[model samples]
Target: MFDKIKNIFKSDKEENNVTHKNAPKEVTVPAHKIGPKSQDDTTTYVIIGASIAGVTAVKTLRELDKGAKIIVISKDENIYSRCMLHHLISGHRTIEGINFVDGDFMEKQNATWIKKATVKEIDPNNKKIKYEKDGKEEELAYDKLLITSGANAFVPPVKNLREAKNVYPLRNIEDAIGIKEQAKYAKNIVIMGAGLVGMDALAGLVEIDGIGNLSLIASEDRILDKQLDVKAAKAYEDKFGQKGVKIYKNRMASEVLIDEDGKVKGINLGNDEIIDCDLLVVSTGVRSNIGLVEGSGIETEKGIKINEKGETNKPDIYAAGDVTGTGIWPLATKQAEVAATNMAGGEAVIEDRFEFKNTMNFLGIPTVSVGFITPPDDTYDILTYTDGDNYKMAVIKDDVLIGFIAQGDISYVGPYTQLVKEKIKVDNLAERVFELGYSDFFKIKEDGQFEW
Candidate 1:
């Protein structure tokens, strides 16, 4: 089923073009005066989220159809990179530095932005949306609608957690700021979940001067279990051990302890252990924000269901970003482009080629895992090379390379990714895997042409 879904989005050019590439940089435009108006129709476009996906849709739509009115409504006060929220907490970036687009992006795109606005409902039948802002309800209509509402942090239900103060879930800039302020005097910080968010938070919190004790609790035995193999995960485990970030595996937070003032005091683990801390960060996981379309007759499963063209069950409505339950940044951007292209009367489709590209760096140790890390049993031959902290692994089935993982040393990640997409025969390359280089794979032909 997964292969069939991937094949549906596979384009001829995409199957050949494998190296990691970024979407077009956001175009900076001069600011222009704008004001609110009553309901009026002029081919307006409405996008629910203002993050990467929604913003990219606006940019792509503008390029295809120049004069269409665009309006972006988001509960967030400003547009910031979700991935860079850790940078903000660590003092590596400021609010301005984390802005995904320029200050005049809405003005330049001739788009209206409704900040801190909550979309209460999506009415596909009437082509309208009901939203509330500052205790007032408002209705807006659109010719086309893109649901990029994205995802929200999923905090598990623990006793006293709801009433505990100074507890945060790192999803937006506001969350990061709140954590930063609490970290100022926090001596001990206990974080739940050992996934990407928890580890990144560990890396960022360690940089703060006063944060002395850090404990990361997770239900899994190893970090990044979904992305890394056992040995590769151990390397991170060892590194975090050296950095004084305590890792408690196979444990979940069962209770939240608070002080007399209802402030967070500590956490009680399911393993009968109590971790005393001043601040708590819940980085368990995320759930799609699909509340707006729950009863609007739009099909959804874990997220709003969409095709390769980013079209939902309803006409003139589309969905993308984390709300689609797809992969991370690259896939989100591609989905946005495809959705916007079709919305603007252009033809485009999202290619699944780059969905395999996943990379994460913790305290300067990089891990790049592409394609399936764990393949079907007895179907593929796996080759592994581990020297000290550096590890490289590859998956080959039917004489073709399918997956690659380079943990410590990620220098040849791009070339490996390219090889996977090209699906070149690995009969000759398998024997010479240890001493691999560009020449070993892409050789010069008899006519002086390079076989890429």
Candidate 2:
């Protein structure tokens, strides 16, 4: 079953500049805190969301200033990796193994962790935040505030969807747990959407041995339409087809079928196609939780609007992570760092950097995409290479290395990403396309700089 996706093993050599080598060794389980600490007389740096953004902010702030108090409030009861929830469903990793930061992260950073708490109102005038937890309202004072509330799953409007008992949305640990438990007894499962959520959900579901029939429906003509072009989508389609996951595209589900007992049974497509299934999983994208700052007079668009320093229109208030509308891992971490630095009285700016590099190991296929895989017009020079299921496409304009995609062997991704980041001129090597190597376009100098 894995042959179509799996291939010869190769050591992963792609990595970014960030490092997490010194994360706390002792792991601390997240728990609820009733309110703010009464004894702490120091300056408070309050951050919302204990996921990647919040954690990174507190850690970075702690390193810059030791005396300031850092408080992290999370609406969830426990801290878990949103990205690793699929690993939990697939049984490839235990719940404990999905910790995004080191176990002892909070303790080492000396930051107070508040769980299951929702911020109700942000009072910029008094520098106070009113929150509700466990049916009680409380207020916490802060010198600086960072909102990283993240996003919530967006479920499209479908008739009778709310009435279905077995319909689920994959967003957090609890959602993954519910889906995993339901999959045990479910003989047929229908998944909606083909984006990241749907793809990850399908990846995990296919790993379960008891899965009988799997169906995926999306409005796009191909899977991962937002992330991949036609050829790349075809590659993934073929791989998914080999796994027995039936896919229906160019159709939107109009109604969710419910049995007499109010349980999910199937779905009615716009084209009058009905897919029968015992479980329905909705993976339609997400919407940023920007409502927390909506009425507070802070600027916002699709996400909370912010400046280069992550500062909102309100004084001493900033935003980061998915709430800022940029929802990628590396960018999220960088935003957190920049927000923390300015909050700690240090000067830092979130520089505008362009490197369209993203990699994914969906199912067993190693896919790497760099720069612009799709060009708007035919004037751009496009080069491609294919070997069986392995594929590569390089998009070039004006003799500069702009974008490329390496599906199977991604060992060359690091160098390719570096070339794009550096904006190296490739006019001299137009004929030597798709051959990414160190010696092909660069020469190492004694000063550690590579000459083009």
Candidate 3:
């Protein structure tokens, strides 16, 4: 499947060459002006959500079809990177500072942004969407619709977990603000689930002053089990331990203990252990926001289904980003661009579907994991290089590098990612896998461009 996807990206170069043929001619327009639909504005592109995917789609559509109307509908008032919410909680960045785009992005794109609006339903049959803004409901028509509604944090079905107050999930900017506010007065803070988001929550509060006992509960044997091996995870576990962060591994929160005021007081573990918790941050996982397309005749399994062109089952409707469950930031951006190009009558397809890639920087320790962390069976050969705090590991199957992990020093992440994504064979390399660099694959073209 991955080889096929990569081949598509290589072959699509020809398709991209003809994109401008179908694309509308460039038109100069005044900045900060979103005029009424003109006679030439035959296509109205309505996008849902305002994060990476929706925002990228807006920019791509405008660049492809200058005269097309672009409307962005989002429940979030401010457009900020959800990935950087931890920075906001740690006071490393403000709400405005976390924005991934420029301050005048909407104005520059000549797009209409409808903020703080709740989408009620998507009427594919009528080519309209019913959404609620302020106190009234309104409907918006569109020639093409892109759903980048993203995902919502999932809270487990622990007893009293839903009804308890002072419990938050670190998924949105609002959640970050609430967590930061509560952390100020929290006596004992417990973060449930030790995945990426759970670790992010820990990273945000680890340095805060006056916070009482900080604890992390993970159902897996070690933290970040999906992203790192036991040894790699132990490096971070040791760092968190040194910082007085209590970690309970192989445990699950069976119930939420509440105080008299319905605020979280403690949590009961599945093994009958109880831990005090003034504030609880749930980061188990996330589920796509597919409610709008529930009855809109769009096929969905786990998330909104889309073809290579980012088209849903329904015509003129597309889905991208977390709504399609491609949670990776880079993949979401690529999917949005593909959807936008197709919507603007250009030719494009989602080419890269490799998802097992993640980078982490916690406690000042940088790490990058690409492909699989563990081999499927004993047929794979594993190589390792370690020097002091720096560690690098490579998994090879049939001479082809299948997975890689770099911890402490991740300078070779780019080459490692390329090698992994392209399924390059490393058996011929005279140098060790850890010594791999860009020079190994560097090719200087006549145009002074470096190709790998």
Candidate 4:
């Protein structure tokens, strides 16, 4: 891990000048205490999404200056960790264990929280939000509104799907809880899609007792294709098979077999393959929610179009996290902090580009990938290794390192991502790189340091 960060700093061979590393310093947010700092400003910042970005945003704003009013509104309490849902599904950790936060945590930060409101609409020009809770319609006005309303689960369209019983999507707290309740009645579990959540769900399933058979199906040829190269993905899929997890690739679930009254009996694949399963869990994909921005005057594309600073088209209004449709959570979360800071009268920014990669446990495969992007054509130099059970690979492009993948006995994900995010070129040659190692220079920073 230390070596990887060293590579990032040493690989500063880019054409443009990037900021040098800054020393660790204290960060003070304004939302902690209301004050008359810049303008006639008794601004109320309403932020949605409470998982990561929302919590980070509220805390960030409070720490920036603590002079602003922050109201955090979400459909649920700040307890669920979406990242850990797969583990919950696998039975490695219970839903109660992963969800640690609640209303009290926010109160300690001097912020007001609306725990059970579902945002219905946004009157962008009027600077107001419409929501519903307990059968009551409520409208809240804000001086500064931060829309961090996150993404939603992508439900797949399969025949007899609704008729099938015990169908679950591993996402929010409610979903995990539902799956847990249903897991007891079923022996076999079929998790659709071999993506991160599906793989993690399988990992979670292995830890649970009374789970007779677990089948993982991939519509694509490999798992985590969006985040890893073919070879790396293959290695992990092989690992899944070795773990006694059934692997079905290059096929889509076409029809869900249901009982007479309608409950999942089994699922039929595209190739006329029928697999029996007592329960079905889907982790197909995720789509950003743009309803809050619709007709709200915020620039709407595939995602909410925010300026480089995460500001929506309207003044004093910013949107971040999944709703911004930025496609990157870290960037979205960082943008939330930046937007919150700037909203509270501080210096903050958002960049136009960022690296897209994720490295979590892929079916218990010690794997990580960053910028492991295979360009349109075979144009870059690729270096890979697989000595016995160990595997490692580095990608260099245009005389600069562009991406790399590390697995089993490899620990350089931090440096690899930082290097890709910065697009830094190494002073050492590719040979020297694998030899000298990244720890010689790169640095590892925490999530909210305002680097990159």
Highest-scoring model, lDDT? 3
Candidate 4 has its poorest 10 consecutive residues by lDDT at 16-25
Runs of candidate 1 with Cα error greater than 4 angstroms are: 1-41, 375-382, 396-402, 419-425, 428-430, 439-452
lDDT of 2 by residue, 261-334 (tens): 99988889967778898998899878889877756888889899989989999999999988888756556666
Poorly placed runs, candidate 3 (over 4 Å): 1-39, 428-431, 435-452
Q: Write the per-residue lDDT of candidate 1 for residues 375-423, one digit (tens) a residue.
A: 7797788889988878998888877778888877778776677777777
lDDT of 2 at 90: 83
When sorted by lDDT, best at the front, the candidate numbers are 3, 1, 2, 4
Clashing pairs in 1: none
Give candidate 2's total backbone clashes. 2
Q: Top model by TM-score, which number?
A: 3
Candidate 2, pairs of clashing residues = 26-104, 27-103
TM-score per candidate, in order? 0.85, 0.86, 0.88, 0.83
Residue 438, candidate 1: Cα error in Å is: 3.4
